[model samples]
Target chain A: MASKLLVDIHTHVYLPRYASLLRSRTSVPFIRSSTSRDGKLDERLLILDHEPSGGRPVGPQYWDRDEKLQFMDKHGIDVSVVSTANPWLDFLPASQASTLAKELNEDLEQYCSDSPILPNAPIKRLYGFGLLPLVPEITTKSLLDTVEQISKLPHLRGLIIGTQGVGKGLDDEALDPVWTAIEAAGLVVFIHPHYGVDNKAWGDKDNGHVLPLALGFPFETTIATTRLILSGVLDRFPSLRLLLAHSGGALPQLSSRLASCIDHDPVVASRLKHDARYYLGKLYLDAVAYGPEELGFASDVIARSGRYQTGASVTGPAVRSLGSQRMLFGTDHPFFPPLNSTEKWKSVVENLDAIDAVQGWTQTDRDGVRGGNAVALFNLVG
Target chain B: MASKLLVDIHTHVYLPRYASLLRSRTSVPFIRSSTSRDGKLDERLLILDHEPSGGRPVGPQYWDRDEKLQFMDKHGIDVSVVSTANPWLDFLPASQASTLAKELNEDLEQYCSDSPILPNAPIKRLYGFGLLPLVPEITTKSLLDTVEQISKLPHLRGLIIGTQGVGKGLDDEALDPVWTAIEAAGLVVFIHPHYGVDNKAWGDKDNGHVLPLALGFPFETTIATTRLILSGVLDRFPSLRLLLAHSGGALPQLSSRLASCIDHDPVVASRLKHDARYYLGKLYLDAVAYGPEELGFASDVIARSGRYQTGASVTGPAVRSLGSQRMLFGTDHPFFPPLNSTEKWKSVVENLDAIDAVQGWTQTDRDGVRGGNAVALFNLVG
Candidate 1:
């Protein structure tokens, strides 16, 4: 039997082409180089408005392949499925976004395919989730063409998207065809949050980016995914292979409330084919939540989604076998790197430790979350 | 041992005077009499903008004490701790809100104090949480005075408030005196949601009130509480005794992420005396979440918060004993009433059943959530 493979399905990368595109822009999403405290040069990626100190400091860890591989090796990560970071083409107009998306997709493919083979593993060390030009100006044909492009790329296993779909959000009817196309292509749709909820929700506190990054991002994903489910996208296309970042945000925690709301609402009660919790079982979640109890809770919600699918009572076994398999391990590298560069990233350690620590999980459950889930879901081969 | 008691800590009511006050207003929050489909006169409570057909249907269930008592008898609920529903004194001017708050406190005290004795339980079947004039124009003196009035009321054990504190959000420094007063008075502060996050987050979909009630209300609570924590309010007043509605919204699920974000942010990294998860254990969450899995998950989050209290590793003990004790059963009655009035309220049953069905909860855990916790928390006695 193959030894346990530690795959990271939620790591990220910014291809050189995409970085150059941002460097040329003068907007909030632009990358501006700045000097570190030690007199070394680093780039600041300003993605949101009113970002403190220009934006987050970006360095070789973001765009350098060797840095990613080294980070992987240092952390005992056997394989990484990387994707482009946020503000993904949302700032561009139609034609320019369409052109850049194609180029970036190719660059990502080349970046992954060019990676060296792992000494301990038979497969290449890197795989990628390509980007889509989901900007409003892009034509549906162009969008479908990009979907086709991503599907054909040998090393690209999925496509990463923000909450906004063609500028109207994931619930918009306009994106139904895109969902249909993605479903048909059999590529995993990685739903990540870029534009968090309105900043007004955070109030006037200068508590840095804690509220936005922690609450806003997750809340945004929860809202977007709930909207998508309420829109009957899941009901219409049951086979869509989608992956949610931040462990489905708060969806797993809020699924039962959402289902109750749907049941009580006269307008939406009869619209869904199954209980709202059922959809949770059907989707993939990155095990990026930092606590064992939460990870266990999320898995329970996912596992129980199966019962909801059958309209069965959810009072039986605490967890179904298939639910933990839907959760994949992720490091979210380059974003939450430790302040002390020599220390293991606390963010990564917390999630990995959570997988190990969650009660009721067998070694199989832990091993599955660590890598087997991603390998199976992404169809990764040696 | 005494018979297991079922206490509902999250039920709501609007006093006769408050109902009449709404009847006198012409704004969105004003109550209007309208004919139902069955041609019977019913009051429509419109609290938000663009509410469908004014707003939700509010009948005798909202303001009639006898109706509440009868409903409790039918559901086997031995005691209820009711608070004034949303938009509580938020729509009034400073002097008007202040005057009304005092009057409402007196009314709430009278309402609970006048309740009939329970046949099965030794205590009176009803208790109350008083209202505060949280409007922006209200003076700090008036706020403190209201807190004083509530503390002196025999039946009013806590004070219910919306996310807005003296106009600014809960994090506003202006609320420090109010928190200090509530803490000094030893009154539990029930933090509810009135103004959800900006509706723009819900997108263009018109899927009834699910988005706002299910997602927005909880999201609003999560943000407000997070802001309150980030501002060092908890650090300043550790024993403030906060009871959050809708199971702390998404706070438990997002607590670790919030801690991670705080650690990563240099400005707010050292702001709090404890980890974010510790704050959750310090809070009392209502078991208003609609499913057993969610209830269990929330309990786990609460229980494991102990480890984070001492900065201990959260890898051990899936659940701590004190955590489940912090949760109390809540019906959120008067709202989410059964559409088919002949049948039992599904909302109430879901919550009740959640307590019964949640895994790993001993009979003690179940009984505590059902009523024992509330009885102890509210200091109820025969």
Candidate 2:
């Protein structure tokens, strides 16, 4: 019956209170009322659209628990590890960021605890990764305290963060306290990229959202994770488990090149003797790659680079160890929504097809990637 | 015993006059002289150095024709279709740019005519791709006139161009005349990236040139080609041939996503009903990917995207009709110099190894990529 163990670690949702908070604001991340040609008032979120034409139609799917359950049931997802969508608490005032983070975490925990709103909804199938208050000027103490608070949330498994950290970047040494705290808390840092590469890179800048979303997002993830690798953050925090969005954002394909560049650089080599390939294994990647070939390649890269042992001859165990447990399924919902369609979301289906087509993948591996791995990794089930 | 038909479509060389011209300036693309600690005068070209530390030591290998023959022989390369390296003539004074380009083209043609300095060097194997002055203020007439003149150079195959055109980008409408002339001349445009994506994308404004070279170069190429695709250039000039560096700079992996974005966009869909995948088969990607797996994936993409027809399906005929003449091989020499060894250049060796690793690639296909394809595509042999 197709395992029926499918888990989506990449899905996103906007809770009711969060939606209300956005509707009350006036700037980015806010919803505004605009009159349609038919003269009806419509609420639009101005996140993507620059003009005053009300942002994309926001509906119950964004905020209502029933809709989330319905979508999961229709997609045959056994479990959905949801997280608040992008621009998450990043715009909140520094003083209010922490308190709001706490409230959101508690509210989300309550939602997960509540009964399934749909009949025949899969049992024990809802969990979430919480958000962090990362606005600039927030005290490191506050950030650390928030981490401490999130660590104790019964349903919170990890923290979702954007590329900008304290407004410098992920490479900033100032972020060491936060990294250390997150590592110490045994929480996975789900690293996603919100701010893409500079807009000038898009050239004459007329392709609309294609450049930023298709290229910018993944490229940003690649650069941020590369900075982390180059800065020796992985070495310092060996236990730091990073979950990269967009399937490690080109990291799997570029890992060899990264290693080659490091090997070729005198300065980089003098400080680090370990292979760059070794660090890739240390990081866990979500299976959000769009196709089976890409998924196979990502899996093969992890298998080859992360193998646990090495011998002198050609025949030897790999030096690092990773298994299907290291991978998780995700659906980058809310974003990449089906355009001009009322049928099933193409984005979700493509991802599901990728899982279906993974070559030589055992039932255990499939199960683990689908739901079992995330369940164990995030403690999704009680 | 090995294929003596080896061709290098990607090789680069800087002419002596051009080197001298750079030596006279103080800005980027100029040469600088400094006193070394040993009190010896050191002359260096600025292209290799970021902070202008007396620039990089310029040697005969960079400017001397005999040295080019020697390197080609040492590396077992039979024929080399060389072009002027990056920052080509994009910075020239408008009045002087076209004239200088004419002179350089003649100089290269004369050099190719008098080659074979090495013992038993292959006959008629050295060819050149001329340079164009693409900076702003240069009239489209001047650009067209230069192309017309170079079109008659027996050894000139095409023009090597950077991303910038008339200070806007490749997508600028002003480039249409230039493209039309080149397409009419049947010259294959070698598209390379010089100015990388903004340096700010690399973060901290420091970390040396690693970020730009390692990340920015490919990112720039990807954006430029995407702009060309998005601007309807392919549809406008279906006959124009383009060779992209760095295996299309992440385009293969992102093509699916690009197609999906276009499929979903109302603006893009309203104008173009064809899938983005259709255009990829028209683009010619060099085999400079750094590894076997990458090469395999690229080759697989070519086959899957219907760029490589094998009599297996309908897409195969379209790919086949495009001709085996479409794809070519290149060595981005002098740029990625061997880091720390006196051994054969690792960059060249790695590329060669990648060519060797692509499984089931026939000798015909192999020879074509090595040199025959470029020879036919550019009409290199007379």
| Top-scoring candidate (TM-score) | 1
Report clash pairs, candidate 2.
A7-A370, A10-A330, A306-A320, A307-A318, A307-A320, A308-A319, A308-A320, A309-A318, B7-B370, B10-B330
Candidate 1 chain A, which ten residues in sequence have the lowest lDDT sum?
A313-322
For model 2, the stretches where C-alpha displacement exceeds 4 angstroms are A1-4, A37-39, A48-54, A115-123, A306-327, A358-368, B1-4, B47-55, B117-123, B307-327, B359-368
Task: Quote the positional error of residue B261 for candidate 1 in Å.
Answer: 0.8
* Model 1: per-residue Cα lDDT over A1-382, one tens digit each: 2238999998888888888888998887999987779998887889888786668888789899999989998898988999999888888888988998899999988888988877765678889998889988678999999999999999999999999889889998888889899999999999999878888888887877788899989999999999989999999999999899999898987888999988898779788888898898888999999988778888888888767875576557556445788999998998998999998888889899989988888999899999988888988775
Tell how far residue A284 is off in model 1, in angstroms.
0.4
Per-residue lDDT tens digits for candidate 1, residues B25-78, read: 888789988777999998788988778655877878889999998899889888
Give the top-scoring candidate (DockQ). Answer: 1
| Top-scoring candidate (lDDT) | 1
lDDT of 2 at B20: 82
Instruction: For each candidate, give its TM-score against the true structure.
Output: 0.97, 0.90
Model 2 interface RMSD over true interface Cα atoms: 2.9
